[model samples]
Target: MSTLGGAGTPNPNKSFEVVQPPTDSISSLCFSPKGNYLVASSWDNQVRCWEVQKNGQNVGSVPKAVMSHDKPVLCSAWKDDGATVFSGGCDNIVKMWPLASGGQLVNVGAHDAPVKEVAWIPEINLLVSGSWDKTLRYWDLRQQTPVHTQQLPDRCYTLTVKHPLMVVGTADRNLIVFNLQNPQTEFKRISSPLKYQTRCVAAFPDQQGFLVGSIEGRVGVHHLDEAQSSKNFTFKCHREGNDIYSVNSLNFHPVHHTFVTAGSDGAFNFWDKDSKQRLKAMARCNQPIPCSAFNSDGSIYAYAACYDWHKGAENHNPQTAKNFIFLHLPQEAEVKGKPRLNTGRK
Candidate 1:
C-alpha cells in the first residue's frame, strides 16, 4: 500500500491508495459489519470486493470477488452475516451475491425506475430499496417481488437504515422518516433543512437522529423527538471562499460515534455532533471524493476519489479523471470527541 499525491510530506493520517480501483466513478462504498471486507458498487456496472490486510504498520488489500449488473450499480449493502451483498442499479433491478459460495448474483428485487439506494434491515431480515420511481420497496430474498412498498413524496436520492430507524432523502427537498418497528407506515415527513437538493443522509450511531447533507455544501442534524427540536442545527462545510461543493457521503465512526463527510471538493472532515466541533480535517485530494466508509471497529477509514459527475457528463475527462479508493489509519485524536470543558467556581 502506497500513499499517493496529496500531502507533500509523510503523515500517518494520510491515505494509502487501494489497488485495482473501478474503471469508472464509484457510486458507493460499504464495509462489512463483521470484518474488513469492503464492497464497492460503481458506474462501471460492476460490484467488487476487497479484503483489507493490515500487517503491523504496513497495509495491503486482496481482491475478493466481482459481480456485474445490466446497468451502473448505484448502491450496495451487506447481510448481517457478512456472507452476502445486495446491490441495486440503473437497470431497475437488485441482485444478491453470496460471496462465501462464490456464486453468481441472483435477481432479488426490482423497481419501476432506476434504484438509487439499497439497504439490508437486519432487525427484520428484509431488504429495502429506494428508487427514482418515488417508492421504497422491502424485499424478502426468497422471492423476486417486494413484500411491501411505500410511496415517497418524490424520487428517492438516498436511503439509510439503522434498526428501528430509517430515513429517506428524496427530490424536491423531501425528507421521510420511518420507524422500522412498523416497517410499513411513514413515521414522519418533513422538508429538508437545507434549501438545496439532498446529496446524502446517514443515521447517527445511536439511532436518535440523522445527518443530512445537501448539494450546497451544508449538513443538518435533526433529532427525531420534537421536544429536542431546539437541538437541531445545520453547518456549512467543504467550501473554499466562493466555491461550494456537494457533500457526497456521510459515515459515522462505529466506536467514537463522530461522523465524516466527504465532498465534491476532494476533502473530508471528522465532526462531533454532540460537541458541535470538528475533530479533524484532512488534506484535500486532487479529485472529488464520491463516497466513503468506516470499518466496523472505526480504526480504518476508506474513501473513493474521482469525478462524481456533479458538473455533468460534458465536463468529465476520461483521460484526466482518476478513480482510486484510499485506506486511511485514523488516529484516535482525529476521530474522538473533544472533552467538554469544565466551567465552575472551583
Candidate 2:
C-alpha cells in the first residue's frame, strides 16, 4: 500500500492511490517497465490496470481494463520493452495482452493444472510459465503452441529468465538454472540449502545471481557464474513464531543495489544484494503480502491481501489506510558546519 524511494524511507511529500478492487486477496502486482502504469491481480478473479500520474496521483479514473478469469489470478509480468504483458491464474493457463491498448487478454494454453507463475522475456519474444502440473513451458509469441516444455520433479512455484538462461524454483526447495542458449541440452539443476518449500525467486537485473525465499523464513542468495562449491549467503528473515506461511513476492530496485521481499507474516524487508544485509523493515501487515514490484526509478510499491485479523490489520483498514502505493524517500543528510548549542552556564 506504499512506495519507498532508494533510501528506504517513506516519501510523505509524494504519493499515489489506486482504486481497490473488490474484497479479495491480491495475488500479484506489477509495474510496467515504462513506469507509467501498474497492474494488480486479486483472488476475486480480476486484473485491474491504472495509469500513474505525476506527483503520485492515480488520476481517479477507472481502470484501463478489468479482465476476468475463472479462478484467482496468481501472477503477472510485463515485457521488457513494455509492449505486452503476461498473466497466469488458477485456471491453468497463461494469457498474453497488448499493452498499447487496455490489455486484452489472449489465451495461451501451457498446462493441464493451475499456472503458478508467468514471466515475459522481451529479449527473445518468449514467455515462460510454471504450473502445479510439475512442468515449465516456454512459448514463442509468434507461434500458437509452446516451443518447449520441461517436466520438473516437483511443482514449480516461481520462474525468471535471464537472457540465454532461465531459473526455476520448485516446492521441494530446489533451484534449477537452465542455459537456454543451448536449448537442446538438459537444465543444470542445483539443490539449494533451504530446508523447506521455496516460495519465491528473483533474478538480479544484471543476471549475475538470484535470490530464493523459503517457508522457513530464510532467503538464500546464489551466484550463477561461481563454482558449484561456492556457498550461498543465507539470511533468516521473520520471527520464529512468524514462520513464512508464504514467501510469495519479491522485487529488485530499479536503481539501488537492493531487493525487497514480502511473506505471509505481513512483513516486508529490503536487503542489499552485494552486502547481503537487511537494510530496512517496512510496517508489518495483518495479512500476507502476495506480490510487490518497483517502479522504473527505483521507487518501491506493494499490495497485501489481508486474510487474518491482527494489529496490522487494524491499521490497514480500507477506510483509514487504503492508499495502494507507499513512497519512500531518502533522508536528507545534515550539513557538516551546522551550529551547535552549548550547555555551559554563565
Candidate 3:
C-alpha cells in the first residue's frame, strides 16, 4: 500500500471536485489535446465542456459548452487541434462538434448498433468508431459516410488508440490489434489474458503494448511482440477481502508512461508498470469511478464518480447516486517510477 493517500483519507488540498457536474451518470471523460479544456459524455444524452482555469497553485473550472444527442452519449475524443470534439452514443450516430467554430453538431458517421467508442487518429486524419454491431468504422468527416468498415469478433466493449497502434476489446473476451498504417485490416486477433469480461483497454504511451482491465478486478499487461511475452503478467486490484469489483477504466500518464486504474470499487490507483509497484492509491469515493482521463500534459487527472449500472437496475439508488468529476494534481513522487535497487550479484 503506497502512503500518499489511503482509503478514507482524501486530502481536500490536493484535489477539487468540478462544480455543475452532469445530472445523470457520466459515461466518458476526455481532455483536449492542446489545452485544459475537458469534455464529458453522459447518460443524460448530453455532452458538456468545461474550461479548467489554472492560476498559480489553484485550479478551477467554468462551464463552456453543451450539446445533446437523441440518446445518451457513450464516448468522446478530441481532434488534433483540440478545437473539435467527436462523440458517439446509444443513438447509433457519431456527431462532430467544432467547439471553436460555434457551429452546429454535424453527423459524421453511423453504426447499425450503438457506438461504444470513438477516437481521433491524427496520423491517418480520420475518426474511428467502435460499435456493438461488431464492427469498426473509419470516418473521413468531410464525407457523411464512413470510409471503411472492418468486422470485429464481437460487439466492441472498449477501444484505445495511440498513433500507429489501435486495440479493440470485444465480447466473448476477444482482443483485436490493428496497425493504423493498414488501418482497415486486422493486424492480430487474440483472446484476452484475463478470464472475465473485458471492461476497458488502454494503449501504452510508447505504443508497444496495452493494458486490459476485467470484471474480475484484475489487469493484464500484454506486449505486442511474442518475444516480450515473458514480461506479460496479470495482477489483482480493486478488491477488499472476498469482494471484488470491475476495473472500469485505464489511463496512461502522457509524460511518465505510468498508468492509472479506476474501478467499480469507487477507487483509483496509480501504478508504475516497469517497477511493478503501485505509486499511489486514492481514497475510495462513495460511488464507482466509471471513467477517467489525463490532460495532454498529464498535469491534471480527471475522474468521474457515479453509478455505473454495473450491478444492474436493482442496485441503483437514483436518489442517492452521486455524480462528481474530480481533478487532482498528482505529485511527481506519486506517479514517477522509483529506481530499481541494484544487487551486488547478477
Candidate closest to the true structure, highest lDDT: 3
Candidate 1's TM-score reads 0.95
Count of backbone collisions in candidate 1: 0
Per-model CA lDDT versus the true structure: 0.88, 0.67, 0.90
Please state the error at residue 269 of candidate 3 in Å. Answer: 0.6
Q: In candidate 1, what are the lDDT values of residues 42-128, reduced to their tens digit?
A: 999999999998776677989988889989999998998989999998999988999989887799978999999999998898999
Error of 2 at 336 (Å): 21
Candidate 1: deviation at residue 298, Å?
0.8
Tell me how many clashing residue pairs each candidate has.
0, 9, 0
Between 2 and 3, whose lDDT is larger? 3
lDDT of 1: 0.88
**Which runs of model 2 end up more than 4 angstroms from their true locations?**
1-17, 56-62, 227-231, 240-246, 308-346
User: In candidate 3, what are the lDDT values of residues 1-346, reduced to their tens digit?
Assistant: 1111124433333477787989888999999988999999999899999999877667899999999999989999999998999999999999999898989999998999999999999899999999999999999988987799998989999999998999999999999999999987889999999999999999998889999999999999999999999989999999989989999999999888889999987788999988789999887876778999999888899998777887687866656565789998888987888776676758
